[model samples]
Target: MATDQHLTEHTTAREELLKGHVLHVVRDTVRLPDGASATREYVLHPGAVAIVPLLDDGRIVLERQYRHPTRQVHVEIPAGKLDAGEGALACGQRELLEETGYVAREWAYAFTMYPTVAYSDEAIEIWFARGLEHRGARLDEGEFLDVIAATPEEFLGWVREGKVNDAKTLASALWIQNVLAGTWKLDWQAPPDQP
Candidate 1:
């Protein structure tokens, strides 16, 4: 096994393979720890945020939407990619509002995860929200999804039954379970610039 410092792959050369509207693919020549050379290809991603909106009724907001690549509708937490120069928290708040029509009074930073670390540098920050008010969704044009409420138990069950397959959502659900069980602690705070 290699030590931490020895595990680093030094990029010697890079080639831009493709650049889509949201995805940028690259191929890189790297120097391995043992002075070997190899090629690595991966996707460069603009980080994103996912929010677990906890309603006052003890249920959380969820969405059912079609995922084109998978060709299957999946249940997920409200989430969105961070726009250029946008903060993760702001993206979370914006996504929650646009996707679910919900605004949260309390927001807690929960977890940050790499959904596809092996080949992609994508990260999804998870947030927990409460003190919600329904203000009606402001979805982006061409966006179509159904908003629903589910207890943590129900969501977890879906996960266990292989229903909730989205990586970030499953991790967020686990965070919720631990938070509710007092095993995980969340630092709740008001958004900056808000009274």
Candidate 2:
């Protein structure tokens, strides 16, 4: 049987305005079975996408770049913010090209992430990309990075060794393993990749 970890009891205690980006305040004052109540405030974000582009021989492509917010260079799956109204796969393809300068023969939307529900609305759609061939990057202004290739086993090992710590990348990499092993599924009506 599948285990259900959903919280059984919880209610909003209060909300405060700390900053603006889609309501920056949140409170979790609702009591639990153990009589515990706590309040937490977190940031809100629109959402994004992550692409795990894989090579026919099992290698996965990653990008190393500086995240201005963290002020650290981190290796992550190719990803980007949604356009004014761009679909996930479209955005994923664009990001794959812009960040890694590569294209895939096939790609599939794998899953999604809420980052932290208690914190923000930054959900991200993860894509599993394959059939890769180099195409060269189309970097936008002020962007810089290098493409690094690692095998799937190496990628997962990196996660275990604390090298690939990006949440979306980790989750999507695991999902790719599952999907390739026939244990994962796609939505019945997944939106088609934008041309």
Candidate 3:
């Protein structure tokens, strides 16, 4: 790959467009690598975490929820935006329990993904979890979804059929597939005590 300095854009000025409850929009004037000035607008996200919870029976937890933007029900791994100053692993554990009522004894850092590079700075950190014990889900106010379990084969089949097409979920499928095939590995750990 070429050096980044040759391709980097330097921000000269910035303007706030909209500050929504969850999204912060901004436009910036930048000097391109070729010394050309341009305007760029993008969303500033707080980042998020996604969990691939594995069960002893060889199944993984998933969710079916209707997203307003897409206006379609999506099958996704448990995920949520990070709380202010929250760590990736902490957010993952919190989301898994709050959404699926499952707690894992073992956790592993899988990978991170940027779903939208051109229009948003949203990063989702993905984690793998196992040794699950179901207590009860404590969904946040105004949150509703159906929790389901699927085997790796079934999930991959959905991916091929275009049923599971959400970017974050798809990215996770890639990692999970490789991990199952022994092409990738994860460092599993026990959960730390909550503060």
TM-score of each candidate structure, all chains considered together: 0.96, 0.73, 0.97
- Candidate 2 lDDT, tens digit per residue, 48-136? 88988877887888888887778888878888888768777788888888888777777776778886775676889888777676777
| TM-score of model 2 vs. true structure | 0.73
lDDT on C-alpha atoms for all candidate structures: 0.90, 0.75, 0.93
Give each model's clash number: 0, 0, 0
**Model 3, 22-137: lDDT tens per residue?**
88999999999999999999999999999999999989899999999999999999999999999888888889999999989999999889999999999999999999999899
In model 1, where do residues sit more than 4 Å from their true spots? Answer: 1-3, 193-195
If ranked by lDDT, best first, what sequence of candidates would result? Answer: 3, 1, 2
Candidate 1 has a TM-score of 0.96
Best by TM-score: 3
Q: How well does model 3 score by local distance difference test? A: 0.93
Ranking 2 against 3 by lDDT, winner:
3
| 1-195: candidate 1 lDDT, tens digit per residue | 757867899999999999999889999999999999999999999999999999998898999999999999999998999999998888988899899998889899987899988799999999999989888899999999999998888988998999999888888877889998899999999887321
Worst 10 residues of 1 by lDDT: 186-195
